[model samples]
Target: MRVQNLVVGFGPQNDTDPVLNGVSFEVAPGECLALVGESGSGKSVTARSLLGLAGDNAWVRADELSLAGNDVRGLSEQSWRRRRGRDVGLVLQDALVSLDPLRPVGREIADSLRLHTRLGAAARHARVLEVLARVGLSDAGNSVRKRAGELSGGQRQRALIAAAIALDPPLLIADEPTTALDVTVQAQILELLTGLKRAGTGILLISHDLAVVGRIADRIAVLSEGRIVEQGPAHAILTRPEHPVTRQMLAAIPVDKPRGLRLSPRAAAPVSPAAAPFLALSDRADPVAPRNTVLEATGLVKRFTRPDGTEQLAVDGVSFRLERGTTLGIVGESGSGKTTTARLALALTRPDAGEVRVLGQPFSAASEKERRLLRPRLGAVYQDALSSFDPRLSVEQVLRDAVGGGRTGRGAASASAATAATAATAATAATASAADRLRVLALLDAVGLPQGLLGRRPLSLSGGQRQRVSIARALASGPQILICDEPVSSLDVTVQAQVLDLLDELQRNLGLSLLFISHDLGVIQHVSDQVAVMLDGRIVETGATARVFAAPEHPYTQTLLGAVPRIRF
Candidate 1:
């Protein structure tokens, strides 16, 4: 596959403002060529142009574009469709959105075979199972019957790969394929792609992660602002980078960096005193002691009923303590009970056999009325921030609602004094409304957002901006503890670096205890003072982050460390 002087624009008027401007690259047979860049840097646009999947408004122009020695410059939609599954296969990043939700996964795979090959129904069914097993889904019999939503993140990604390779296409395009996968599962996916490369298939790999690219790429091309800044062998570009953009991206990685050091350029500046006051909780007046356990769980157990009418233990005998003003990182693969343990910590889910205590008060075992007063002191940030927000509400409304919800004293007045009570209620409402507005603006400032975004909805904001708003909402309650579940997993490296630095600074200024959960071990090492390694619904290992990573005792922990991709430089 070759692309020379490729240019793609949104509309006819955007000829000079093309999304991909003069981008050129080549993928040889039995080779993997990586395209590395941040978000909106034309990586996805370039991939789409090759497959003729660029939108209707796109004006695509190239001096030379060919796949398998055949020109694909001006192919009609029907012609491109005919060549898609037979000659090229595209494995998108999000499998949950890529695959049909209502259809069985097996049927999704069979449809590709039915479209590109002349196979009977029975033969296609057999091939579906074979392909599923090939992609490491060994229990293809059960996986074939389940829908895409029923599978875990890794399983769904593997299912997407299985369908893409069912026809054995010679050219493959994978776009951010391992963005949110665990280190172990990402290693498996990388191995599968490598196997395809060894089988004489040319691959175009698009990703923002330089570590993953260094592991599999034979050649690398760095893209910035719709142009290729550098292209050469993988080793030279990673180790001895020539372009300033390449160097900046390498420096932004938080793998080996220590805590209290800034990962991004923006984080070097001092935190504003005005912003500090908004993030600080009442506990900031007291000095934080190392032994103060702010959140703790003992002998926690959670179970779920599967589709087969069998019980599955999601969390089993899990116990941990989070100290005040420190971060406790949880590392695990998908379905390892990290998320369930987080829910238990947040009191979002109840445990069947254990109890949770927040600041020496009963949390998980307490009734709703008993826990309501204490709930304002805890906040949570989820992986997908866009889904967590209300689509109809503006940024100001979201923060105001959170601030109002945290106040629990508004409804305590008696109903006996009718006229006087009504006048008092009116005055109180006016005062609270004025206070809420000020708090909302302060929350935005604490999260480093501009006041211009107050009127915009969440869907209109960028990924980084949405995450910042999510953090602002979490801080609206003046919480002493913050729970972040895969907060930066889906962001690009530069943006991820800024968010991590922000969280570090917030912890310092607010005296906040953090329960940080992620599958990326490098992030765990950078942000966590203590780390817990989980596997199969239990904590297998726990220790100081430096000690645990430097000398892992458990075999599973060792395996996980070994699988992590590293940039040699």
Candidate 2:
């Protein structure tokens, strides 16, 4: 497979700016060619153009585009559809959004066979199970019946890959396929791709993760704006990054940084001591003896009944403590109860048996009334912020809602004055509106967002921008403790670095405690002071971040760390 002088643009007008400006690359048989670039750098557009799926608005043109010695420069949609599954397989980035939410996993995989093969129902079903097992989803009996939502993020990703490779296509175009996976699962997925490459399947790998590309990619193409600024062997590009953009991306990785240091260009400045505390819940309490422990949990146990009516323990005998102004990173593979533990810590889910204490107060056993009172101090940032956010609401409204009923009370008071003094009431409403606007501005500044985005909704913003908005929302209520669940898993490395830096800066400036949960050990090691390795619903190892990473005590912890691909350069 090869491409030369590929160009793509929207609208019929040739004068319009093109997304891909003469971009060219190739993937020969048994070789993996990676296209590395930041968001909006035409990587996805280039991949979609090959399959004639760049949407109606796109106009694709290439001087030469051939696969398996067959020209495909300007194929019709119907022709491209016929060739898609038989010639090229596509594994998209976000499996959750890509896979059909309403259909069973088996049906989704079988759709590919139905499109490109003449296999009957029984044979297709059997083939689906075989492909699922081939992609490391061995529990095809159960996984086939389950919906995409029922599986973990990594499992969903594998299902997508299975569907892509179900017909055994010669070319595989994987666009950030492992973006949302944890380190261990990512390693497994890369190994699977490597096997496909060895099997003579040419792979066009598109990603922003250099480490992932460095692991399995044979050649590298560093894209900046709309062009490939550097292209060479993977080792040469990684070790000697000739392009400045590539160097910038390499420097943004979290592994090279120390704890409590800023990775963003805008360094954190000390907030005024007299400034109104935002998300500082513990400080408002009556002065007492200084306590180091901010959050603690012991003997936490949660059980769920499976579809087969079998009880499964999700979190068992989990205990840990988080000090004030510190981060505790929980690392583990998919379905290992890491997310369940995070939910339990935030009291988002009730544990069957356990005790949770937050800021020296009983939390897990607290009544609804008690929990409601304590809710103001607790905030959370989820992996998918767009799902958590209200699509109809603008960024400004989202932040204002996080401000809570206080703003509503002000509006109510202003309305009450309308009957007495119309002019004065108008003035009061204006004042209240200005105050709310100022508060929203402050939150945006803290999260490093431009004031221009206040009117935009979540859909209008990019993935990284939505995450920043989520972080701003989390900080709006002035919470003492924040729980971040895979906050940067779906983000590119450059954006991820900024978010990590922002969290560390916020913790230092506001003295907020963090419960950081992720599958990426490199991220955990950078942002966390203490680390806890969870496996099979239990804490397999716990220690200081540096100590554990330097010399892991448990084999599981060592294995998790070892799976993380290092950029030797």
Candidate 3:
């Protein structure tokens, strides 16, 4: 596959401002070429142009564009469709969105074989299972019957790869394929791609993660603002980058850094004077001094009844204490009970046995009324910020509602005002309204978001912006403890860096306790003061982050560390 002077643009007059401007690259047989850049850098647009899947509004042109000796430029929709599965296979990033949720995964694979090959029903079925197994799905027979939603993150990714490679196309295009996967699963996917390359298949890999690119790429092209800023051997580019953009991206990686060290060079927004008191509530004392325990769980055991009527233990005898003004990172594979433990900590899910205490008081075992009063002290930020927000609410509305709904002081005052004068009640309501607005604005500033975004809905915001809003919403409740579950998993490295830096600053200023859960060990090492490794619904290892990463005692922890992709430099 080769491209020279490729240009792609959208709208009526696309040539005025193209997304991909004069981009050129090549992927030879038995080799892999990677396009690395941040989001909106024309990586996905280039892939789409090659496959003729660029949207209807997009106009693509190239001085030379060919795949397997056939010119791909100006190909009709029907011709491109004919060449797609047989000539090239495309593996997208989000497998959950790519695969049909209602259909069995095997059918998705079989459809490709049925379209590209002259195979009978039985042959297609056998080929589906064969590819599934080849992609490392353990129980291919049973897996074929499961829908995409039924599978874990790694399993769904494998299913997507299985469908993409069923026809054994000469060229494969993987776009952010490992972006959402855990370290070990990402390593497996990288290995699979490497194996495919060794089999004489040309691969075009697109990713924002330089570490992942450095692991598998033979050649690397650094894309910046729709152009290739630097192109060379993978080792040379990663070890000694020439472009400023490349250097900035490398510096943004969170690995090999100590806690509280900023990942990005940008400074965090200062806390407003009005919001200062709220953030500094716990900051009055020495931050490094021996602090009290903010949250604790003892012998936590949670079970769920499966569809087959068999109970599955989600959290088994989990126990941990989160100290004030510190971070406790929970690291594990997809179904290792990391999220379940977080839910148990938040008191969102009740444990069948055991107890949780917040601020040295009973939490999980308390009544709903008691929990409601204490709820203002805790907040949560989830992985999918867009999905977590209400589509109907503007940014201002979301933050304002959070502030008004969770203000324990206001609630108590309102209860006392039931017998107070009506004029006094009106005055109090007006005062609260003004305070809520000020708090909302301050929250936006705290997250480095512009006040102009106040009127926009969450769906219109970018991935990073949505996450910032999520953080701001979590802060609006004046929570001393923040439960962040894979909060930065979906973001690109640079944005991830900024969010990490912001969290570090917020924690330092607010003295907040963080129960951070993630599958990314690099992020865990960066943000966590203490680390807990979970496996099979239990905590396998727990220690200081530095100690755990330097000298992992458990075999599982060692495996996770070994699988982490790292730049040679």
Candidate 4:
């Protein structure tokens, strides 16, 4: 697969600028080529343009385009349709969007085989299991029968990979496969891609994570403003990058290398011991004040009944407290119950034992009336901002409903009056009128979202902007505690830094208690004051942030820290 003088964009639109410039590169057959850039850098557009998947709105032009030595840009629509899956495979950033949620993942994988080949149902089923098992989804025969939601994040990713390779397309283009996974799972996914490269598959890996690209790609292409700035071997580009952006990229890969090369300037905020508690340290600071206690969970436990007739304990006997004005970071591996703990704390799910206390009252066991009373005290920020928000609704509507102040749709004025009537009872506790609309704008500004975004939907914004809006929505409820789960994972390092700083600033100024969850240790170290290491449905170790990171005690904790890549000067 090779791209020469390839240019793609929405073209010079009446309002918007062209999306891409003259982009050119060549990915060798059976080789891994990585395209690295920040959001809106045109990397994604370039990847999608290869198969002419950019749609009619896109004005794409390329001097030369060929896959497996066959000219692609000139193919007729019918030929392109036939050639798409059978010859070129694309793995999108969001697996849920790419794979139909209504169908089992197995049949989804088998669909391509049946469509492009003469394989019957049984043969296709057998092939699905074989390919899925090869992707490390073991005993996939039963897995193929289950719904896509039934699988874990890792399993779901493996299933998607299996589907992409099922038809054995000569070229596999994966766009940010590990964006949604944890650290360990990310390592595993990278390893899988490396193996695929060894199997002589042409892989076009597009990502903003330079560390991931450094680890996987044989060659690297740095795209900026829809144009290639630098292209070379992965080691060369990462180790001694020539382009300024490439240097920024190498410096941006999280401190995961464990050793070698000194970081330029300083990338992340200096780890602040004064911020929050973390890891295995033994200093118990006085409990943050009552108004500060936004969310607290004691002796929380959650168990799931598996299809295998066995009980899966998601969260077990967990205890944590978030006070106003601080970020409490939670770090753990996949299936280690991190997410379950988040849900338990929020009263989003029922816990088998223990109770959630929000703003100083038992929450999880609250009656319907009790919950309604405390509804305004709770707010949540999710991982994927795009799906969490309604596409049809504008940003203002989302915020209006969240703040419990307005009726935003057709009968907004009447609805607002009605909402005011029902909210009158809860209103007596706090602000009587409703949450201040000015505060909403303030939150948006704090998160770096523009005020103009109020009229636009989530789709109109970039990934970082959408995430900022989610942050704004979380802040709109005026909750004492804000639970953020991997808020920055979908963003690039620079964006992640800005968001973290914004969160920290907001934490201090607003006296907000934060329950933050993430798989990145460096981020955990920087963001948390107190840290708890959870593993296998249990808190393995909990201590002061600086102490635990300085010298971790638990073997599991040490193993995790060891897995983090480091850099040397």
Candidate 5:
């Protein structure tokens, strides 16, 4: 397959600003060509054009475009459909959103076979099992019958890969396949892709993660804006990058970086000494003495019954304490009980056993009334900020509700009100209106978003902007404890760095405690004051960030650290 001088644009207005500017690349049989770039760099757009999936408004032009010796430049929609799965396959990043949630995963795989092959239902089922096994999802007889939601993150990703490669297409396009997966699972997925390449499949890998791509890519192309800034052997580009954008990306990596230092491209200032007290060691001899523990979980255990009527332990005997103005990062693989433990900490789920204490008060066992009284002191940021908000609410309305000045389309207002300890202490009507408006704008400024966005809805915001708004919303209540769940997993590398820096800054300036959860160890190492390694529903290791990282005591912890991608600088 080859694409030379390829260019694409969306509408009449986009003609002058094409997404791809004369991009050119090639993929030989049994070789992997990695298209590396930040978000909106035209990597995905270039890949989609080859499959004729660039959408109707896309104006695609190229001096030469061919796939498997056939001209793909002017293929009709019908021709593209016939060639898509049979000639080429695509694996998207998010498996949960990519696969059918309602149908059994096996059936979804079978649909592709039915469309491209003459196999019967029985044969298709056998083929589905074959591909599922090929992708390392060989559970049991009924494994393929499980819905997408029923599978773990890794398993769901494997299912999507199986569906893509069911017929063993000649060319495969995998876009950020390991972005959200844990290190071990990410390694496994990359190994699977490696095996596919070895078997003589031409693969196009698109990603912002240079380390992951460096592991297997035979050739590399660095993209910035709408053009390929650098292209060469993987070793040449990674070791001695010539382009400034490429150098910026390499420098932004969290590996080997000191704790509390900003990882973003923007100018960074040292954490303020006047910030709230932290239990972590620091040079400041007179830093404020330790304050009371803000959150504590003791022997937390949570259980759920699966659809098969079998018991499943999501979290087991997990214990951790978070001090005032510090970050405790929880790192683990998918289905390792990270999210379950987070839910228990948030008091969103009552543990079957054990308990949680918030601000030195019993929280897990707290009644609805008591929980409401304590709500205002806690806030959360999720991985998907757009989904976290109501699409109908504009940014100003969202902030107003969060500030407890007006009714929110979602429960932002009620939640804020519930968290506030006293209605009497709440601002008066006139003062509330003025103060809330000012506070909303202040929050926006603090998050690095312009006040002009106040009139726009979430759908109109970019991913980075939406995440900033989510952080702003979480801050509106002035919560002492903030919980972040895979908050930066889906962001581009540069954006991820920016958000991490922002969170670190916020923690310092506000003296807020953070419960940061993620699968990326590098990210954990960058922002955490302390680290807790969780596996199979237990904390395998816990200590100060520097201590635990310097010499990991647990096997799981060591293995996780080993799997983190690093350049040989």
Candidate 6:
């Protein structure tokens, strides 16, 4: 398991130099070698080049690249396929997309075994179950036939790990494997990986999270702009870093401290006090609408039955709402009905019992078609935008599709065209100049993204860049209310602050209402007008954001707030 003089990237496009220069690295048996860098620094390209899977568009070159002493640069596709699962296992960033949507997760794991082993069907099944149990996916025996879509994010990640290690590969390459998970689940995945390392499986870990890497890696390589700036023991690199980039990263991590809120993490690097606040919820000069009687619910219930004959109540008699143009932040652990409540408001899902209304309209009862008509009234943004965007479509197409530019034929063009012509006669909304280009520019600028990135596809952008595009797209509809489901969960702290500030600006300038959902209590406190603490599918405490923080009325809220790791100076 070693590589030297390994390099990979796209060829010259209109005369630009190589995307990845001659990058080199190595990983020894039973050791964890970490590669750290920002997006497009060739972190993923180097990873893909190891298995000869970088694709036709990429030009791969290496002097000596060996996986178990077998030269990778010369290996044919059929030959590399044999080495991939058998000698070098890979767990990608997105477990959901990495796994086959058409196949059962268990069978995906089973397929790994069948490809590399001569074992019989029964033996293979037993082996797959064994690996799944090792990864702590309980009831592996029963979950063997479950489709990838049916599993949770953490569960899907566990399944991916199970598949990667099914053949007991000596080397494992994990690229941001825990990026999409909650902190607790992240700890669990780290524990499992560390346990495997102890049992003689060397790992090549790739991550943007320094803390996570600090906890797991024995050695670290700090990469900036596709170059390894520093390489040494993890402790030495972290506590006694010798590079400016490394120090810049350390400054970005949240440290426990006492302060009202220092510089907003939105700055590209550390900024002086003049920098903006992280997510200024107080941007509105006017007071929020009266706290009580603004939004309320009673006896709300939602339930689902699993394919394994297990019943799960996603939301049970839960009741909560928001003040007009004010943020009501919902804090809950995963599977605690946070997403369900958002869906109910957007009319994406129908509840079992209880009424849901937006400023007092029968929201939950609206038909899906009617809901689309009302869609412009309510906007949304999710945690992972790559999953939401069609990878095949360019970013321009995604926003254009959302803005009602391409659906004219199906929308009774003759009748709609007349209506548009009539309205255009009055305001010229349908005139040749009425295209949404200004709207697109305004939205992109609002989210702090340059207009130059508009032509690129979602796949070509960084995670943070992709998120900005999603925010711009959500606002493209110009909804009165926006529902954000952990929108910054996948971002670095610095990027997170930028997004939060952008949301704050939108709320202030456009008077947009926000239903902000997150597990981070600090974010909730900083941005929420009112806070609703949910636990086990119920809102245990609901009140003014400051009041709730000053004196949380519920034990669960107390516990959740207490668990928030404070920043140290």
Weakest ten-residue segment in model 3 by summed lDDT: 281-290
Candidate 3, residues 258-343, lDDT tens digits: the string is: 88787787876667677775444422343432358888999999999999899999899999999988999999998899999999
Say which prediction, candidate 1 or candidate 4, comes out ahead on lDDT.
Answer: 1
Query: What is the overall TM-score of model 6 with all chains considered together?
Result: 0.76
Please list the residue runs of candidate 2 whose C-alpha ends up more than 4 Å from where it truly belongs after superposition.
100-133, 139-155, 266-285, 288-290, 405-433
Q: Give all TM-scores, in the order shown.
A: 0.93, 0.90, 0.94, 0.80, 0.89, 0.76
Model 5 reaches what TM-score against the true structure? Answer: 0.89
Report the Cα lDDT for residue 279, model 3: 48
lDDT of 5 by residue, 235-351 (tens): 998999999888878877887789776677773323334212221222123232235578899999999998789999989899999988889999998888999898998888889
Positional deviation of residue 383's Cα in model 5 after best superposition, in angstroms: 1.5
lDDT of 6 by residue, 180-234 (tens): 5755567678888999899899999998767678777889998877778899998
Candidate number of the best TM-score: 3
Q: Is candidate 1 or candidate 6 better by TM-score?
A: 1
Residue 84 in model 5: lDDT: 82
What is the C-alpha lDDT profile of model 4 across 99-217, one tens digit per residue? 78899988898888887899888999889988988899877778888777778787888888988889888889999888757777777888888888888888999988787676778
Task: Give the Å error, residue 108, model 5.
Answer: 3.8
**Candidate 2 positional error at 335, Å:** 2.0
lDDT of 2: 0.85
lDDT of 3 at 168: 90
lDDT of 1 at 410: 29
The positional error of residue 286 in candidate 6, measured at the CA in angstroms, is: 12
Give residue 244's error in model 3 in angstroms: 1.5
lDDT of 4: 0.74
Better candidate number, 2 or 6, judged by lDDT:
2
Model 6 spans > 4 angstroms off:
12-16, 69-71, 101-107, 118-122, 240-244, 247-294, 304-312, 321-326, 357-378, 384-441, 451-466, 473-480, 490-494, 505-513, 519-536, 540-569
